[model samples]
Target: MIRADIDPKVGGHFLVIDRRPTGDAVHYGVFLELRRPRRMVFCFSAAEHDHNADRIQIDIEPLAEGTRLTLSHEMCSEWGQFEEQTRQGWVHVMQGLERELDAMQVVSVPEIVAQVAGEPSKASAP
Candidate 1:
C-alpha cells in the first residue's frame, strides 16, 4: 500500500512499494490504458529489474451484492515456471485486503462529537 497514485489516464507512470511474503519489493511501471473506474492496463516489474516482468490487466464488473474482479497478469516466457508462486502471492495480497475491509467501520456524527468533547457516547435513547 505504499503507492496508490494512478493518473487515471493513458501512458501514466506508476510506482509503488509492494510488500509480500517474498519481502518488500517495489513495483514500477506505466499505465497503458485507463477506462475510468472500470478497467486498467499497466505493465510493471520488480524495481530491481531493468525491464518489465508483467503487464497486469484488471477488469471490474459490478454485481448485485458486490463487485467481481478479474485480474490477468501477462509475463515473459522466462518467468513461466514461477506462475504458481505468483498466483499464491496475489492470493495472499487479496486476503490482506479482505481482512482490512472487514475491520472498516463508519462512525456517526454524534460519535465524532463525543470523542472530540472527551464525553462518553450514550446508547440510543428513547
Candidate 2:
C-alpha cells in the first residue's frame, strides 16, 4: 500500500498492490477515498483470485499525540473458516505500519536540508 495523494483536510488516496505467497503479484487497486488522519475506505479485487471480494474500511483517530487505527473488513462469508487468519494478518500489517510511521517522524525536513547543504555542491562552493 502506498499513498497516492493527500489533501490533509478532505482525505487521501492510496495505491495498493498485493502479492501472493508464491511471490507473484496478484492484485492491484486503489483506496478511493480517505479522510485525513481519520478514515479510509478501500476495495480490492484480484485478477487471478476472487473478483467480488468485499471492500475494506479503515478508521484512524488521534489518541494523546499518537493514533488509534481500526479496520473493518466486509465479505467474510467468502473466506469461510479462514476469516480468523485474515484478521490476524491485518493485525500484523497494522503493527508494521505503525512502526514505519514512527520511524518516519524521526527525520525532520530541516535536518534533511541541513545535511544536504553540508555536502559539496557540484556547481560551486560558496
Candidate 3:
C-alpha cells in the first residue's frame, strides 16, 4: 500500500510526506517544492524499493479557479514492474493532492500577496 501526507504551508511551498510498503519492506521520502498557486513542480523518489527510481516531476495548471496537476515519472525502466504500479498510484494521489491544494488556496493567496508586499513571510519567520 502507498500512503501520503500533504501539508500546504505558507508561501508557495508544499510538503509531501509519503510512505510505501511492499511485502516485508517499507520506503519513505519527503518532497518540498515550489508552487505558483495553480502551477508547481516537485522532486520525489523511493529509496527502499526502487533505489534507481528517478525523481518524479509534477506540473499543475489553473483550470477555472481550480488546478489540473500532471505528474510524470521518468526513467521507468529502472523501476521495472514498480513503474506501472507507481503510475497508477499517482493517479489516486494526484486526486488527493488537488483537493489539498484547493483547500490550501484559502491561505496560499494571502501568503503570496504578503510575500509580494516584500514582507517576511510567515514560513520564514522564527
Candidate 4:
C-alpha cells in the first residue's frame, strides 16, 4: 500500500491506497466495531465500486503455538464475479502479515510489489 490512513477505534474511518499494476486501488472504510486483539467489524468499499459496500468481520483467537485469525467478508452480490480475486487478495495480505509478525521486521512496499509482479516469495521457497 502506498498510503494507509487508519483510525482503529469504533466509528473511525480508514483509507488505504494500494499500488497495483493496473493503477492505484483506493479502499475506504469505517470501523463498525472493535474489540482489541479479539474482534473487528468494518465496512469496506473500493473507490471504483462504492455503491455496494461490503462488511468484513475478523476474529482473532489465541492458540498455543500462535494466533488463529478468522476473516469473513460479506460482499455485495454485485461483486460475486470477483470472488476468486478477492480471496487471493486476502491470502496475500494474510501471508504478508504473518511474515511481518514472524520476522518482526517491516516488509517494504517494493518487495511486495515485486512479489505481486511475479517474483517468487519466501513463502514459496524450497
Candidate lDDT scores, in order, read 0.60, 0.49, 0.43, 0.72
- Can you write out model 4's per-residue Cα lDDT over 1-126, one digit (the tens) per residue? 899999989989999999999999999999999998788899788853465677787887665555567787777676677777877898789788777765765432222211222221112111
Over the stretch 32-126, how does candidate 3's per-residue lDDT look in tens digits? Answer: 45555553444344453334435444665545444445555554344555644655665566556556756877633211110111211122111
Model 2, residue 5: what's the lDDT? 34
Name the better of 1 and 3 by TM-score. 1
Off by over 4 Å in 2: 1-21, 30-32, 48-51, 106-126
lDDT of 2 by residue, 1-126 (tens): 422233322223333454557654444345566676666676554442444555666776555545556666664354445555656666667667656666788622221100111211122111
* Model 2 collision count: 0
Off by over 4 Å in 1: 1-8, 19-23, 47-52, 105-126
Worst 10 residues of 4 by lDDT: 117-126
Instruction: Check candidate 3 and list the clashing pairs.
Output: none
* Better-scoring candidate (TM-score), 1 or 4: 4
Sort order, TM-score high to low = 4, 1, 2, 3
Choose 3 or 4, whichever is better by lDDT.
4
Please state the error at residue 105 of candidate 2 in Å: 3.1
Global fold similarity of model 3 (TM-score):
0.46
Report how far residue 1 has shifted in candidate 4, in Å: 0.6
